[model samples]
Each structure stands twice: as structure tokens, then as C-alpha cells.
Target: MAASGAVEPGAAAATAAPSPAPAQAPAPEHLFRPISAEDEEQQPTEIESLCMNCYRNGTTRLLLTKVPFFREIIVSSFSCEHCGWNNTEIHSAGRIQDQGVRYALTVRTQEDMNREVVKTDSATTSIPELDFEIPAFTQKGALTTVEGLISRAISGLEQDQPTRRANEEAVAERIDEFIVRLKELKRVASPFTLIIDDPSGNSFVENPHAPQKDHALVITHYNRTVQQEEMLGLQAEAPEEKPEEEDLRNEVLQFNTNCPECNAPAQTNMKLVQIPHFKEVIIMATNCDCCGHRTNEVKSGGAVEPLGTRITFHITHPSDLTRDVLKVTKNPFTLGDSSNPGQMEKLREFSQKLDQILEGNVKAHFIMNDPAGNSYLQNVYAPEDDPEMKVEHYKRTFDQNEELGLNDMKTEGYETGLAPQR
Candidate 1:
């Protein structure tokens, strides 16, 4: 054995194994790249990886970007040189929404087909005209156009066709006829309805008319079913101990309730949440496992406000397409008999004015009349000042108070005040 403090120089080299090369620290990875408040342009990073198709060297490019007026997403594309196969997928970097969203768009124009669509892996796509549906979890998430979605589905159906033709002639013939019909939709021969239902609420369909109602597009947000919660892995494990009182606002409180649809008993999950600069509101969501019915409703949690609130906002360009605002649709004006030339001229003038607003050539005012004062138009510069928004509080009228059932409400001396009415 070598001496404790002294070793033969040649012996040490021969006895000891070669030191392993210093391992390099891996490049720090993040699901999404940090971006600043201003608009940003993100570039893709390319890496060499093994191809899943041919087991050969392939190139994978990753792009972490934020969609305009939307959330951040990671887009990955892989291409194999040997097999000439390629694939792409999009994953949202944002948190799961509290509710699900369904988008139905009537595709009537080429521009409609060119609209950008974000479909999550857990989203289902359907065409009502064709009675065709691509179920959730069957395809990866995508960031593509309406036409691209249909084209991809067509390609997927055709992939196994050659084998089917050799083995099952009858099946091939039926599919061929279906393929021709799908091709007709691609050509925009007639109007079709495209529906995307996403339980995660992470999917999106671009709205050409923002800050205004789109007649051809109808979007509804609803509570997810119990099964959807499990499928999305959002079923929170019950706490071992009871939730503390201090955290009641943050805790999800479940209460026994009856389903409004089938009258079956179920549970309604509720939480006290405060919207920014808005009053605390209770968001109650109910799901009935018996009838598979789901419902979401928001209730103002405090006493009626003393005064009503009205917000008048100047609508500039409709870029905030993702904002969820209630747009009440009503007829602009009643049309008179077409035989009257005077009424026809008035209608034509009104139509041109509407066209100007929709074309972004003229600005419009969007007003919100909230009697409860809790409802509000979202302020981008909350806690600060926004030049475009004007908020005013006014005393409710007698009719308004009657409608709210506040005619007999008394802030002071309610006990004596009610005796007179009795």
C-alpha cells in the first residue's frame, strides 16, 4: 500500500481510474420564456434529436410564444429527414380555466376558413353539417387554421386507406365517398358549422369582430362535468383536515344541492372570489352525475349597493378579442314596410353607419348599466386611470328600485320603516 501522505507519481496514475470529464450543467429550460410588458418576438430553438419514426437523427424546433391578446403557448415541431415525416403540437403554458368554453362558428367565407384556431388535446371538434366529429384525446393540440384542421383530419383518415382497400373493399368505398364530401367543405362550396368544445377552456377561435357581437359566431362558457374534472386530472385530493376558517375565501366549499335539470341530487362547488376592482362575487358551479348536466352562475354576495354604476367606454380597435363581456343583442331599429321608399332610404343610411363601425373606420361607445354596482367593465389600468373609460354612480330611479325589490329597503330605522308599510 502507498504511504498515507506520500504516493509514487507513476503508481498513483496507474492505480487511480481516470477522472470523469466534468459534467456540463444542462441548459436551463422553462415551459415559457419570460416576456416583458411590450410586444415581443420570439424565435425558435432547434435541437438534434432521435426521430420516433425512423430512429434516425431528426430536428426538433421549439417556439415559446404568447399569442396577441391571448396566453403563452409552447409550439414544437419535429421533422425526420430519413422518414420524411413531420409533426407539430401546441401546449398552453397558462393555468387551466375555471370553466369550459364552446365555440360555434358558421364558416361561410374564405376568410372564415382562414381564421386562426387553437385546439387543445382535450378538445373535441365537430362539423354539424357533415355530422363528423374528432373526439378529444384522439389528436394532439394544434395551432392551425380552420382549413388546416379539416385537411389534417382528411389526411389522418386517408393514412390507412391503402391497407383497407386491399383487405376491406367495402369500407374503402364508403370512406371514399365521405372524403369527397369533406373536400367540398374545404372548397367553401356552402356554409358549414364548425364547433370546438374544450373542457379545459384553453382552446380559442379568433373573433373577427371584437368588442362587438359576431352574428356568425356564438361562444358559451359553462361548468365542466364531473367526468371532465377527472379526465383533466383536476380532481383535488381532499384535505386530511377540515379547511381552516381563515382560508375560507380561498377554499373551495362544496354543498349538497339538487340539479335544476333532472331534479336529481348533486353537489355544487362554490368559492368567494373578488374580481379586480370589483366587489366580491360567489361563483357557484353545479354538476349532476345522474343527468350529466352542468351549470355555472355568478351571484353578487353583498347587499344591494346604494347607487347604480354606469361605465361608458370608448371602443377603439377591437384587439382584446379574448375579453369575456356580455353583449346584449337587440334589433337596431324596427323595419317599416318595404313598399315605403322613405323607410327604405332610412334603413340604407343606418346600414352604412353600422358598416362603418364594423370596419373600424369609426369609434363607438360601449356602455354598461349595472343596477347592483358590482358588475363592471374591466379596466386595464385598474387602480390607475384610463382615459378612455368614464365611470359614474347615480341614485336609482323609483322604477329601478322597484325592479330590484329595494323600494322598502331602509339603511336606518328599518324596523320602524317596515311598520308603516305593514
Candidate 2:
């Protein structure tokens, strides 16, 4: 072959592929460089990029891996095939020198937008100490003024008779109206307090235009305590007790009387009798001693008498509805013409209306005005058909007796002319 024509050097060798050279070792500079202070300082000390929702930066692109009841974080810096996003892994090797320094990315079960976990710096690091104390509210004494007096009076009046004879609905409406008016008055007299005396049951508004008087005097006069003393004298006077004979005369009958009919022995016998033009009936019980027969009949004579036919009229000043009925025998009054039948009819109508209103079946309000510009509103209710009134009367009588220092027999009985026969 060498003699064949001065063989072209390396021509056949070039036509054949050269054998692969032994793998060359990588240069030392190509490997990772050791961490240095300058590298640590130059490294991103602050987060440069963050997951928009969670606000954490650990990777260039986060791969969302869903797990059962939880989310998974894949830390490899690989492009996500599903999302087509490139990722870069964060290395703390240059920045953190201590082995204790750790970097972790947590994937919470809850979505970043839905939940937030706040990590607060310690109080010693950030929060300042504070001293807290409750503030005190001081109350001043009530104002002394005519307006104050008026407000107090109105409040006391309403408080003393909170319930009206009107039906519940009507009463509620009236209460609302009254409250509105009270609020207006309160606004007009700011910073003043109104005190009500429900127990005294006497209330009146002082007229600012009128001459100012001492509050104590006004209260005493309004309550009629002073007037009462002057007219009725001091309440210390001893009350007179009924004599013993009156008690014997008024004693209730216990035994059954002899029967006028068939004298047979009877245990239960009672009859009711009606009276003409009266609201009350009478009952009587009788019995026969000889034949053991008993009978009872209501007697017309035993019926309750009608209330006094004579109606008196008097101009009343503003006063509390709960006050005791004043004895106005000496007070000035204008007599209505008793002879005028028409006037009497009107009076009857008025009384009927009042009665209906009091019975809670009708709604009405009474506003009485005196010539002196004083006014009063009275809310009355029909008397309950209860025996408790009688009991109360007896108790009052007993109290009066004790106050008078009367003996039991004298206090319990007095001659009242055969018990007035009813």
C-alpha cells in the first residue's frame, strides 16, 4: 500500500471517524463556590418575589399539588408542565451561616385568599405598655326652677296612675303621646332633673310666669298638707269610736228564722227579690222551727239605695289624679240649675259617657282647666265589684280606732240608730 502511489497522508484516516477522546474532567471553577461574607452580603437579603396570595417567596414559580384535605409544595425548580411556568429554587446557603437557620414553604389546607395567619412580634419588641381605667360619671343635684317643678309634677302624675281605663291599645297610644310630650319638655329644660312623688299622689306644674316660691312651700301647698291642716286641723286629734250599743245593734244575724209556709224542716232556703230602677237585689233566708221547714226571700227593703241624686260641681285646680278626694264643702262652687231638665239630661249623658270610659269599654280623656290657667288630666276607672273595698274600709276604721286610743268595745260598736236599717 505504501508503494501504490505515495499514499496520501492521513486521507484514509480522515475518511474514518476518529476515536472518542477520554472524558475530560470538569474544571474546579465550574463547581459551586464556597460561601463568603461578600457573597452573603450580596445575596438577596429581602424577599424579591412572592406568591401573590400567600405573600411568601421561596421559588420563581410554585407548582400547585393538590392533596387530600391539604395542599402540597414541590420545592424542585422545574418548569411546571401543567401550568407552563418556569421555577427557580431559592438557596439560603450563601445568606444563612448557621445550620439552625431553616427555610420552609408551607401549603395550608385553606386557600391563601380565604384565610390569613397573622404572626405578631412580641410585646417586648413592638407593643408599648398602656394603663386603662374607667371614667367616673358624676350626677348633680336637681335644678331648682319653675320648669323643673312643672316637669316633676307631670312625671309624678303619670307615674302615680300609669294605667288608664282605656283599652290596651288606646292606653299604649296615650302613653306614647305622653312620652313624646315629656321628651319635648325635657329638651326645653336641659340638665334639669324631675323627681316624681308617686306616694304623695299630688302633682302640679308651677307656672313660670307666676311669682317664684320656695320649693318646699310649693310642694306642701300642692300636696294640700298645709290647707288640710288649716281646715281639718291637725291629724293628731283623737278619732271618736262607736259606742258598744251600736255594735250589738249592727251584729249580723246568724240563726234561721221560723218559716211562714209549710213548717217542714228545711236546711237550705234563700230567695232573691228585685227592686224597681235599682242595680242591686236583696236576699233573705228563713226557716220554720216547728216543722223543720226553711224558706228564704229577697226583700225589696234590703236593696242598696241609689247614689245621692244631688250632684255638686266645683272648679278643681290642677292636681294629681291619685290624690284623696278633697272635702270641698267650704270651697267656692257654682250650682247648676237643678230645675233645668235639659241641663239634667246633659249631665246624665256626661255621667254615662264617663262611666263607659271608666269601664274600659270606651276611650275618653278629661281635661279640666281653671280660670287661673291651671289644668289637670284625670284618668279614672270604674270601681271593681270586689268585696275588698269593704275590707279596706274596716281596716281603716280599725287603724283610726287605734290612733284615737279607743277601747276595743267602744271602737267596735256605737249607737247609730238601729244600724240605719240597712
Candidate 3:
């Protein structure tokens, strides 16, 4: 055996330390080479760099540009000759915001989908009508149009869930159908809602009706929950458990109610929840243990306001049908069971005419009369100069208020809220 500290004469060469390789100069900041005006103008400053994938030298181009509505951004494009790898990325110079924003619009026409949108990585998108949603963490933001956003979503699903499509033909077909419908929405053949909820507030939807308050776009700012803040690396305190969500064993109220469908006693569960902007609403739900019957209803617990209001909107395009129109009225303004027969007949005629407007068969007016002043027609923002669109607000008359039971009733010598006649 060889001595522990001894090396053979021929082994000296094999054990020698190799010389350190010379360091390579850092690649130029810009991919193209910059040329002076005297030599050749508009020459690109090309920079040779190693391919990120194959670790070989590659050519890259970096351009700094200020895009309209997007501020300044660095657009970097690179291509590798070794492995044929090409990549492009855009970096925004804008500062990241602490609070998030949400932009929602009803896409009803081809023009609506063409509006430019800027989405950041820290944004979540969803189309509730299609039952599709994408989380923020999974997205790398892009400045694209509404149609581009849908295309990106379809491409991602196809790439990420290859096995799912191969194994389940039915599921794959369903996804294909959904993709077709998504494309149709871009062509104005179908209407759908596009919602972008960004916790980073870096997403934007171009105002279709600019320089005016009336537009179909809505911008809402929401507070992030503790869990959401933590996910976004924001400083947040540990949230305390709410009493309602705590274990039922420690609760005092009886949740088991009766099933309305099956008439089963104590077979239902009820809960009252307060929605944002809207007041308390009771959700009564029950599943029958004997018959498997289920039933549920949502009822508002808030009182109706006294004032009455009227709203009107013009329908010029098929997309206008998708606008949310809410009519809130008291018993007198509404055609209910207590309404006179003639009033109900007139309401029926009105409803038929309104249906015609929604069908785009007529460029008629959409008038909503609410005696309670608690109704809204969201995103009816057509400019006054728009020939095809208009919005009008009307105040309720005293007689209308009286019919709605919102006016004071007078007796022989007394009025409502006054002392009775002696």
C-alpha cells in the first residue's frame, strides 16, 4: 500500500491545481450596439450574453420606452443561438401600490373587448358567467386587450392541464366549448362580464367613455383580509376568529330549522349575512333528510327608503342588454297582488316593451321607476354627445310619493306625525 502522505512521481501531475480561468466582461446593458451619429445612425447596440437555458452565448435587445397609458417600461427581448431559445419580458417602472383595485366591465360588444387593459402579476381575474377564475399568484401580468386576456387564459389551461385533456375526453370537449364561447364574446356575439381583482392595484381598464363620468367601467378599492395581505408579503396582524365561524358546539343559537319543501321539522339551517353596500339579508336554506329535497330563499331585512326616483337609459347596441338594471319600488309603484287590475295590465305592457329593448329590436328608452329611491342601473355611462346613448334622472312627484305611502296622510284637523284632532 502507498504511504498516507506520499504521492507517486507520476501522480503529481494529476493532483496539481488548475489555473483560474480569466473573467469575462459583463454584457452590455442594451442588447443592440449603440452607434454614434457620425458613423451609422439608428444602429442597434447588440450585447452577446449566455442563453439562460443552455448556458451558451445569446443575443439580446433591451429597449426602454414609454407606452401610452402605461408609463415607462423596459421591453427586453433575447434569443439564444445554441438552443434556439427566445424570450421577451416587460418591466414596469411604476411603484407598486399597497392597496389593491378591482376593475369590472360588461363586455357586450366587439368594441368593448378591443379596449386596452393593463394587468399586473398580482391580479386575479374571473368570469363568473363562465365559471372560470385565475388566481393572482399564477399570473404574470401583461398589457393586453380584453380579447387577449381570454386568449391567454385558454393557452395557459391548455399548457398546464395536458394530461387532464388526454385522460378525460368529455372534460376536454367542455373546455373547447368554453373557449369557443369566450371567443364569441370578443366578437359581440355573446355578452359576458370581465372582472379583474388586483390586490396590487396595478391593473387598469381603459375608459371607453373618457372625459365623461358616464362609462361602463367601474373601479372599486377593497381592503385586503389578513390572509390575503400575508400572501402578498404585506404586514398584517393575526386576525381573530369570528364568533359566527367558530365551532357550533360553543354556539347558543339554534341553527336547525324546518325544511319548507319536505315539511320536515328541524331539518333546515338559516344564516343572516351582511353584504358589502347592501344591508342585512337572511338566507333561509334547508335540505330534507327524508326526501332529499332542498330549498332556499334570500330576503332583505332592511327598510325601504321614503323618496322615489326614476332612471332612464337608451339602448343603442346589443351590449347594452348586459348592463345591470335594478328597479326597487314600494308596493304602490310596483305591480303586486295589491295593485289594481288596470295597473297590472299596464305593467305587463311595459314589461313586454322593455323586453323588446333588451332584444336590440328597438333603439328605445329603458325607463325604471322606483318609488323607494333605492335602485341603480350600473355602468350606463354614455356621454351626452353620444348619438345612440343617453341617461336621464327624474325626481318623484308629490302625488307619486303619496301613492307610494311616502307622503304624510292628513285627517280633518291632524296630519301624519301630528297630534290627533281633539
RMSD of each: 20.3, 46.7, 25.3
- 1-422 in candidate 1: lDDT tens per residue? 11121111111111111212212222123433433333244457787877666677878787765553356677777777887867777777555777899999999999899887899878988897887888787777888889988887777667767888999999788877887888899889999999999999989987655434679888888889889999988775575775665576868899885665444567999888888777888899999887688889888968888899999988787652224443222222122221224434554666677666666788888788998677767788889978889999999899888767788765665766654444
Best by TM-score: 1
lDDT of 2 at 276: 33
| Runs off by more than 4 Å, candidate 1 | 1-41, 237-299, 302-366, 369-422
For model 2, the run of ten residues with the poorest summed lDDT: 119-128
Model 1 lDDT-worst window of ten: 1-10
Quote the lDDT for 300 in model 2. Answer: 39
Error of 2 at 101 (Å): 86
RMSD of 1: 20.3
Ranking of all candidate structures by their lDDT, best first? 1, 3, 2
Q: Which residue segments of model 2 deviate by more than 4 Å?
A: 1-185, 188-235, 239-242, 245-422
- Candidate 3: global Cα-lDDT? 0.57
**TM-score per candidate, chains pooled:** 0.55, 0.14, 0.44
- 10-77 per-residue lDDT for model 2 (tens digits): 11111111222221222122122222333332232222343333333323322212111111112123
Instruction: List, residue by residue over 1-422, the lDDT tens digit for candidate 3.
Output: 11121111121221111221221222222322222233243243366776656677778665543343334444455677777766544444444454678888888878788887777666778888877777665655466789888777666555534665779878767666766776666677767788999876667787644323436777777777777777767677566555654343243334554443223444545566655443555666766665476766665545555455566777787787775443222222233232345545555666666666767888867677776655545543332244543334456688776655555754344545666655
